[model samples]
Target: MKPVYVIANNIISPLGDTTEKNFSLLRQGVSSVRLHEAGNRSPIPFYASLFPETFWQHHHTTFTKFEYLLAQSVNKVLEQASVNPAHPKTGLILSSTKGNISLLEENAITPQLKAEISFTQSAKKIAKHFGFINTPVVISHACISGLVALITAKRMLEAGLYENVVVAGADIITRFILSGFQSFQAVSDAPCKPFDANRNGINLGEAAAAIVLSVHKPLNDAPILLAGGAVSNDANHISGPSRTGQELFFAISNAMQEGAVSAADIGFVSLHGTATVYNDDMESKAITLAELQQVPVNSIKGYYGHTLGAAGLLETVISICSLQENIMIPTKGYSTPGTAQQMNVCTVLQPIEQEACLKTASGFGGCNAAIVLKKQ
Candidate 1:
């Protein structure tokens, strides 16, 4: 098997356009989340991190908004890497829970445009735009889509199925989405607070993020290896995670096993930490069960809101930046420990000599995933 490395990455969020800009804003503890008035997005007022209309004005593309956002992220990443999308040895993978779902509300949906709703079709169009020859892969397994897509990319690179793979994930905020979460009472009225005593629910947001993985090392910086990844399911509930968190713990254990690292070797853990009551509690148990209770942990959901499919990829990119800068970003809206198990939830930005980091995510339908990254 070949060693896969992250060559470049890009994030299109309310905070900024590039990974560096987003990292800078996060370093300053700036959050784009705000209380949004009830309009076309939802019938009731809710807090969310939404991009201003001006953000779209900068991207001049003929593709639909969702497609264009994915392209914009990929374009930025391509600028940072030497990989060629037009080459035969390259592949593309897209992740999204909802793709162009907003179009269903339009007055008339033409047959041609209706195809955009299928995640695979949208991936094909985006892949063609970049001249990729292989059939594009699409993953839409709830919020875990992004992390699973990345795991697939790593396997592909290591198997030598492709020399370079562009993995991107995105989801737009729409009435359909807001209503679904609202029905479940999962929408927070204010900014979401992860791992806090007063935490309520998650704030939905929209974003597009892209990463380029390659077998070859970059010349400019130390290679960041996509060390190992593993995923598991609880088989307990569709919308809820395992009460024991044993499944998620299994994922963490399997991921570390694959990376050939022990819990003591992990510097920090980037958590799913969605501000919901059940999620934080489950994760707390998982971390403790894995014997990583003392490792500093932080979640960026408060900074960008729960961006659906984009959440995992976006958080991973930021955490990769954290590893490079030796800084751990604070949990933006956390003040007190709220989980049943005691864990080191970071509350302030601080520097540390991190050699490896763990990223974890759990979503709708009993799905759980964990991945490890290491500096070489």
Candidate 2:
């Protein structure tokens, strides 16, 4: 298979708008999550990371908040690359669990815009805004949406279907999403502590991220390669993950095998640490099953919160930056061991010489995905 390289990328989060800015704040141990007062939609005070108020003032647009985020992220990448959006060989993939679902509230006021609430419709509109020629591909696989979208693009490129693929994912916090998680008792009142003894639950967040992949490498000093990816489902439960973590282990092992890497080769692990009791536990068991207990691991949930569909891609980009700078950011809010299986969780930002890292994510419906990224 032809190797796919990430030539350009961007992130629009509460911390910043560009990848460099975000990484700088991360290295300073700054977090975007904060306590937000309840609104008319959600009448409960909760913790989350929202885009700065000045963000919209700078990037003025008529699109909804969700649409603006997706468009802005993609626009940033296009600014740095020479790829033509209208080229037939170029493809667009949008990843989101709920695209403009918040617009449903406005249905009573403007029934004519009802069709725009569909995820597919929103995707098409975004593609048209960028003048993409081909139909946009949409991935809505819960939290794994971002990773699944990247994996899909890799397959498309390997099959000679597209020369360049742009994958963007974003999800904003809404009343519907907040209430649903609240009902599940999964919304933490305080900042989430992943792999911590006193951890409670997850704090929702909002962000959009994009990455451009191609067979040709860009003219840059640092280059990252997407070596392998794999997805698996345990069929254990709809809302709960596999109790034994075997299924997640399968996906991790397969991704490493396909990447021609081993447990000893991985420099660190970018975990899907939602800070939930079950999620952290399941991931630890899976890592132990894969015999990667000694590998350094960390989660960005405490910094960005859980951005739903955008979490995977956002963290992957940060991990790539970590590899380029040879520094590993610590898992924020983690004070002590919290999982049954012990693993090497980074407690502080450390500089080390490493080549490759594993990015893993598990979502609802027992879905799990893993991708191996190597620094070139």
Candidate 3:
């Protein structure tokens, strides 16, 4: 199979609007957590990593918050890759766990609401924006949505279905999501401290991110190739994470197998450290079982919070930026070691001229995913 290349990437999150600004703040160990005042009963006392609500109020109208943010991210990525929608061979793959439920609720409450927010509706809006004749595929696979979308794009290219594909994933924090995390006691009142001994829980945030994937494009100065990726289900529990590390073990081993690389060759592991007790414990156990001890690992949840569906793509963009700049971002709020694992979680900022990076995510519905990226 031909190598899949990440030609370009862009993101919109609470940390900052542009990719460069977010990465700059990440390198500085800045935390974006702030008090959430929705004036409604929330499970969390105060939430971290929230976007300026004014941006949404001013920039979007008439559509669901998900649609507006998704469109904005897609436009930015297209502009970066110089891909014109007028091109016939291009395709789109959109991933989101919450498919406009914010609007779904709005329509549900008001009987006059014409249509509920659906995958087809979002696809039509995005396709109309690009004037594309084909319908875009919308995928919802819990938190692994973004990386799964990337895998879909690679398959399309390998099948000779399209010369290039645009992969986008987005989800906004809403009353529904906030309540669910609170139900799990996973919403932290304080800023998230991933991999820290004192780490409490995750902070919720909203984000939209997009990337351009191609097979024949010339390798750019910092071409981050999609070496390998896999999504698997633990089927262990509906909400509780598995402590045996069975699923994550499969994901890591599969990624190495597909990339033809050893666990030791992996420069860093961008872990799915959610700052929750179960998630943190399970992820640590998995890494240890894989024998990836001493591999530097970290999570960006402290910076952007958990962006849900968009977390995978947004964090991948940050990972790519780290590779290009030769700087590894510190785990923003980590103050101490949480578990008795041998893996080297990034406690302080460091620099490395890395050639490859591994990104991982595990979410609700017993889903887990991992991907390998290489610097050109």
Per-residue lDDT for 273-313 in model 2, tens only?
99999999999999999999999999999999999989889
For residues 32-147, could you state the per-residue lDDT of candidate 1 as single tens digits?
99998879988889999888998778656457788888988888888888678888889899999988898887737778667767787788888888888899999898888888
Runs in model 2 deviating more than 4 A are 58-62, 109-111
Q: How close is candidate 1 to the true structure, as a TM-score?
A: 0.97
Pairwise TM-score winner, candidates 1 and 3? 1
Lowest summed lDDT window (length 10), candidate 3: 105-114
Which candidate, 1 or 2, has the higher lDDT? Answer: 2
State TM-scores per candidate. Answer: 0.97, 0.97, 0.94
Worst lDDT 10-window in candidate 2: 105-114
Clashes of 2: 0
Off by over 4 Å in 1: 58-61, 109-113
Error of 2 at 281 (Å): 0.3
Candidate 3 overall lDDT versus native: 0.81
How big is the positional error of residue 144 in model 1, measured in Å on the Cα after superposition?
1.0
- Model 1: how far is 281 from its true place, Å? 0.4
What are the RMSD figures for all models against the true structure? 1.3, 1.4, 1.9
C-alpha lDDT of residue 253 in model 3: 83
